[model samples]
Target: MEVKMIGISKSFGTNKVLEGVDFELRSGEIHALMGENGAGKSTLMNILTGLHKRDAGKIYIDGTEHYFKNAKEAEEFGVTFIHQEMNTFSNMTVLENMYLNRELKTKLGLLDNKKMAAEAKKIFNELHISLNLEAQVDTLSVGQQQMLEIAKSLMTNGKVLIMDEPTAALSETEIDNLFTIIRGLKNNGVAIVYISHRMEEIFALCDRITVMRDGISVSTHQISEVNVNQIVRDMVGRDIGDFYPEKTTPIGAIKFEVKNLTSTGLFENVSFSVREGEILGFSGLMGSGRTEIMRGIFGIDRYDSGEIRLNGEQITIRKPSDAIKKGIGFLTENRKDEGLILDFSLEDNIVLPSVDEFSKRGLLEQKTIDEFVALLLKRLVVKAENKDVPASSLSGGNQQKVVLAKWIGIGPQVLILDEPTRGVDVGAKREIYLLMNELAQRGVAILMISSDLPEVMSVSDRIIVVREGQLAGEVLKSEATQEKIMNLATGGN
Candidate 1:
């Protein structure tokens, strides 16, 4: 199979996102598409998958011109896309999600549950994914959910597969499994378009690379012809010195403490403390109670037993509102569900947490709101034409910035971030790291729960490993290693 896209141009209103982009993928070869945040990576993928229309472009599959009116049409042409965003149905089971659009049917035209479950199990085993087919999709971990999305693409029996950051939330072991599956696909003559921010993965897995910057195809080269530094420079149009910014503040006295916290099945006996001007990282395997601990701390979940002390003073928090009132802010793990209201404008979402502050005599003040929004936009570097633009219009990284701005606007004493950089690009990840350090320097204790090992190790002053609803171990900034954390997380003692 061979795929060629020529002179692809797309625009949203006045913004021309993709400008005459051209690329090609050959059979049994992996082609990487690298770009910075808001660089039209998702936009281009959406157009190819028929979610959006390209203003001008020519697509050829196997030497024949092709047109995809919708995702179903793309499927008919053996083109499948695994989106960066989790698009699974939460209410459905793993088998159901895997065979959603194309379900197995019996001779009588009824659904064949047995055949579907068996096929789902077979596909998962082929990918080395250990997930129960009958389990609800929502019960799976974020990494597992991502793997399910990939499985959906494979089920299409497509010659062309487009994977957009497929391993963003996966661990090292899971990533290895994914690579093995990808290699198997390549051996079977499938052409894959791989999009990822991790340079090492691209160099290791891709046969060739195409760089996109400001919506244009800058260059394409074989894996052997380019280096990581050169690729980064081409993607972002700048020399990125350090991916993670240096910590500027020294750790101070403990500002937030949790003692004997237990949330039953979610988490148990979790205890930790974060000092002023210190970044505390919660590390663990999927479903090892990392996010659950943060939820308990932020009062998003009720704990059966626990004690929270802030600045040497014990405080009772019954709910999220109470936690916010006590000067604590939380950025949820699921941004689309809990962080922002997609239909609202960027300004509205930014001021959601602090709207009361801008009210005068029971009336909203537009001037005050605009002033506050302006300051937040400058501080967070939120890229948008106007504050009136809907939150859904922004890219993944920019949407994350809005979530941060919303919580920061309230000026909380303790800030909790769950998977803060899950779907963001490399450039945006650096900015977020800098922001976290700046916040800690301002005497705000920061607690972050992340699945990315490199990110947790780089940005944290102290690390806490949780396993099976309990504290596995605690390591200082200088002592935390990938092996040590993984051992504790997997109960290696």
Candidate 2:
């Protein structure tokens, strides 16, 4: 399963995705692919797996030049790509998804459900994953679905596995279990192409690393030879001073409050407050109701009992529009589906929430709209060729910035950011943090929900831990530590 890609180049309508890139994957090795969003990491791998045609490249696999026609062909040849976005059919059961398109048939040409279930169960057992094969995928939490995708990929008996942000939705315990499974696979002569923006994971788990920037391979080295600083420099082409910028914004009086916010069977009796110029962090394990609480606050989900107050006055928000009218903005964790419309142009997505403000006499003002979108795009440092391009044309980090730009356009006093940096690169993450600081300085209260502990401690002025839908404890930034946060999150004394 040795793969070598030399001088790979690809273009879609003059947008060069990858150019003169070189990569190598050896059997029984964990090779890390590091880059900022739109730096061509995913595109390079897509070319490898035949998802996109390489305009210029030479691919040699096991000493023979080869090019797969499609993803199925790559999988049949023992190469599997587990994308950042899970590709499971939500309506189908776990067992069904695991055997999809490759279902075994009996001698009579009948479906072998029994055999498929057994094989799926065996892989799940091997991965230490506890899941009911009969359960529909949508019923499972995001973390559970992530593990299921991993198991499904393993069932292919792939010699080469390309995992993109595999742990983005996983908890600490689940991440540990996944790392163990990956190690076992490497031991079994499998070559893994690991793509993640989390630097700690790359340094900790990968054996070798290759960094890409601006659609070209910057450098490749043994994991032991290069450090995080070197990788960051190679990916961004600059030394972005600090990973998390200093929080100098002064905290002000209480600006937003939630009391007895309860969603039946989801969260109960939850209460918290964020003051003007304050960044309140919500930390917890996956499925700890952190996201659900934000959903309730933003009126995306119904709360059984709750009182939301703003600027010392209570406000009733029956829908997202109401919340927006009250000067509140929400950046959902699921950016692709909720934050931005993939098919819509960047200008459209950014102006959607504030479109009314840019209109007059029941008609849109194209000039005003263009000016507003241009301003926010420049402010957020969103790298896009043109505002007329679809949001899908941008990378993950740029897409996130576009989402942030939309909220920024509204100029909300209270903003809720959930997993703001999930799957974003180091350089882009620093830029986002700086923007948060600027917002806080301008008297905006931000409630951020994050699974990354260091980010929570560094970015938030104060941290509150949630456990199984309850506020476990609170700690200030000065006194916060990884151990302390984990203790509070896991119900430790």
Candidate 3:
């Protein structure tokens, strides 16, 4: 089967997202769609999946023009979309959620649990994924939930499978497993559309590449014909050079310190300090309590015993408000669920924590609020047409920028960033690194928690390894290597 979209154009009101974009996929090939954030990648895919109406375009399958009314219609035509957002019924069991809308039934008109369970088990076995079928979807971790979403899409057995950042929330091990499954599907003649910001994944799995820029189809080439440099230049119009900036800012006196922070089962006796103008990284495996310690410091999760000291004075922080007022900012790992309120606008989210700053008693200074928002949006380079549009409407990278803007607006003494660049594009990641460098040079203390080893070693002034809910060890950046860090994290001394 082959799917081809020709001269596709779409616009939301006056904001043109995709204009005359062309995308094609053939059976047994993994076509990677590469672009910077807000570069019309999602809009084009939405049109192909029938979730959004294209202003002008022609979709042809097997060289035949066809029109789809909705996603179901597109799916029936062997076109299925696996969104970055996990789509599941949280209240239902995994099996029930897997078989939603297309449930198998018996002649007696009852739900066929036995058959569904077997089929679900078979799919899981094929994918090398394990999870309790009886457990409710809400009980699973984000990584497990993401696996379930991919498995559900596989159950469709569509000819054309569109994956949008399918590995965004997955661990390194899980990513390898997903690659195996994708390869198997490709061998079976399924046309796969893989979208991701990870450069390594693109070079590893994709056969052909299509790069989009500013609502236009920039170019499409065989993966063998292009290198990372060319693709990046097409996407953002310049060479990114080195992704990580040089940390030239000299470290000053300890600006923030957490002494013996303990959060019961989550983490314990986690002691760390961040110097002014320093980028300190916390490294650990996924479940190794790296994020928990930061949460403990920020007062999002209460520590059973600990003292947070800034400069020389101890402070009391019992909630997010307390932390915010005390000049501590946190950008959470789970951006969609925790960091940014999806329903709020970019401008609104940026100024959310400082609402009182613009409101005089019962009155709001609209001009003051607008000025603040405009400045941050320009400073952060949020890359959106209307600041009033819901944050949910922007791409993942742009959404992350908005979240960072929110924290920068707080003017914190110390900032804790958990998985700061998790789902953003490579260009956006570089931009964020430069921003972090700029912040550090300005004397703001930074504590970053990251699972990406290269990022941790390259960008941090110091690295702290966490293992089994404890502070394993700490190393200076000049002395830190991936092997040394991994050994420390896994208790190898």
Candidate 4:
């Protein structure tokens, strides 16, 4: 099968997302779609999948033009999309999710439970998955859920599979499994459109690379003919010298401590501390309870028993507001959903947390809001037309900076960031790292939980490995290595 989209153009209000974009995918080939955020990658894919109507374009599948009315029509033509956001019903079992809309039925139209389960089992076995079909999606880890999503996309045997940032939530081992599955699909002559910000994955899995920039198709290159540097340069219009910024700092006295933290069935007796002007990284596998501990500390979740001390004084926190009042900030992993209000303007979101501070006895202060927002938006280097634009209008990098600006506006003493640079570009990542260094120099303590091992090792002053809800080992930045961290995280040494 061959799929081609040519002369694609789309617009939303005043913003032109895609302009005369062209992309192609041939059968038995994995094509990578590379671009910075808001580079028309999603818009182009959406047009192909019939989620959005193109102002001007023609889509051809197998030499025949296709004018799909909706996503269902696109699917009927053997096209499928696995979105960046996981679409799963937490209350439903794995089999139920796989056969959600198109379930096995008998002659009388009754649901055939055994047949559905068998079909799901077959797909799982083909992918070398070890999940229980009866297990609820909520009970599964993020990596397991990711596998389930991929399996669900193949139910109709799609010829052209569109995957957007599929491995963002996966571990190294899980990514290997996914790549194996993708290879198997390619062997079966399935065309794949892979969208990702990870440069390494593109070089490893993709046979062809397509770069887009500023709502236009930049160029396409064969993997053998190009390198990461060239692709990055094409994507961002410049060479990104170093992937991660240099972290040089001195650790001060203890600024925050978690003593004997025990969360039932989640984490057990996790103890750690972050010193002033230091980055303390918590490294672990996908489900090693690293995020759970951070959630508990941020008061988004509860812990059975623990002692939280700030500046040698114990503080009680039963809710997120309590943590905020105590001068703590939490940067969630899913920034789109948890960190910011997508519909709100940059100015509104910047002062959202400290709205009370800008309020008088019986009135709102416009000057106070304007001054703070102007200073922070300019200070954070948020790229936007103006402060009145909604957060959804900004790119991923700018949105993240806005999130940081929100916390900075609140004047936090301790900031907990979970996968802070998960989906950001190289330039934005360096900006964030520089911001972290600035924060550290200003005496703010940061507890960072990152799955990117090299990133954690590079930025953290000290690193701690967590294995199965327990603290496995701790090492200074100078002494930390990927091999050592992996061994400790897997219960060795």
- Say which candidate scores most in TM-score: 2
Clashing pairs in 4: none
Candidate 4 lDDT score at position 310: 96
lDDT of 2 by residue, 1-493 (tens): 8999999999889788888999999999999999988898888888898999999989999989999999999999999999887788999998888888988999999999888888888888887888999999978877788899999898888999999999988878788889999999999999999999998899889999999999999999999999888989999998999899898988999999999999999999999899999999999998899988988888988898989999989999878999999989999888877899999999999989998998789999999899889999998878788999999888877899999999999999999999888888888899899999999999999999898888999999999999999899999999999999999889896
Question: Considering summed lDDT, which 10 consecutive residues are worst modelled in model 1?
Answer: 422-431
- The pairs that clash in candidate 1 are none
Off by over 4 Å in 2: none
The C-alpha TM-scores of every prediction are: 0.96, 0.97, 0.93, 0.93
For 374-428, candidate 4 gives per-residue lDDT tens digits of 9988877676778999998887657888888898888889999888877666666
- Which whole-number lDDT from 0 to 100 does residue 256 have in model 1? 94
> Please, what is the whole-model Cα lDDT of each candidate in the order they appear?
0.87, 0.91, 0.88, 0.86
Candidate 1: list runs displaced more than 4 Å.
Answer: none
lDDT of 3 by residue, 362-432 (tens): 89999998888998888777888778999998888889899999998988889999888877887889889
What TM-score would you give candidate 4 relative to the actual structure?
Answer: 0.93
Clash count per candidate? 0, 0, 0, 0
Off by over 4 Å in 4: 128-141, 374-401
Clashing pairs for model 2 are none
- Candidate 3: regions farther than 4 A off: 489-493
Name the better of 2 and 4 by TM-score: 2
- Sort by lDDT, best first: what order? 2, 3, 1, 4
